[model samples]
Target: MSRPAQYHLLSLPDGSWETVSCLASVIRCRATTPTVIVDVSAVERLTIDALAVLVRKAMRLRSAGGELLLAGPGPAIRKVIERTGTGPLLPDFYDSAAALRALGDDGRAWQRVELSEGESALFCEPAQSPYCRHRP
Candidate 1:
């Protein structure tokens, strides 16, 4: 089957410990596409625990033959990633467009699925798990 021509976006709330914990739980239960992008543009501050969540997500993706790219992290966030020595493990981009190109996206407007609390999951599976709506 052909890969989905889009990137799934998991938008962070505030990069707080509580929010990151919630995100980690949701991700474990939900299956995402091979190319998932975690957008941190809205994150005003950066925390070590929060950055750990991103690294953990990336490791999971790699095991499943996928990749996780961070998008729109400011200098503060970048410093944490570097300080934590996860820069080599986690590749990031200044924006989604740059990330798309790096992933070989044809510069077309691909679809997106933004994950957040309160809202329905962009990709969710039942226990038996026949399908997920956010494939690609």
Candidate 2:
């Protein structure tokens, strides 16, 4: 995918079970960018359970011939990600702009994408979503 798409995830402030729960449908929507970026700037900390959600989403995107990268982890959250030993798997950036550039998105601010709506982040899905777990 040339000029891979970029999608942003709302920062999780509390990292609590409730915050995680509320993100369920958004993460499982099966419609995201070829390069989904989970922005963690506003997030202060991340739990193992919370990281699991990210990994699952990344895996789902990967299965569809795409990839996922974490963006902007603060000092505390950076410690959590490193201590968890999932750095190689999750691959984070210092900030979202660098992440977007890494994904080949250049200065295309018009292509900004979001995941909370439960619809395609950049465009609508086809009749059968290639990333849908239900697909056989």
- Using lDDT as the measure, the top candidate is 1
**What is the per-residue lDDT of model 1 for residues 1-136, given as tens digits with 9 covering 90 to 100?**
5556556667776889778766655665554455687778888787788778778878866765667888898888888888889987678898877777777755556666544433224334342322223435
Where does model 1 exceed 4 Å of error? 1-6, 105-136
Q: Pick the candidate with the highest TM-score.
A: 1
Off by over 4 Å in 2: 1-9, 30-34, 105-110, 114-136
lDDT of each candidate versus the true structure: 0.68, 0.62
Q: Write one digit per residue (lDDT tens) for candidate 2, span 33-134.
A: 655666777877777788777776666667666666777878886787788877766778988777767766455552566553445543333434333323
Candidates' RMSD to native: 6.1, 5.8
Alpha carbon lDDT at 59, candidate 2: 68
Worst 10 residues of 2 by lDDT: 127-136
In model 2, how many backbone clashes occur? 0
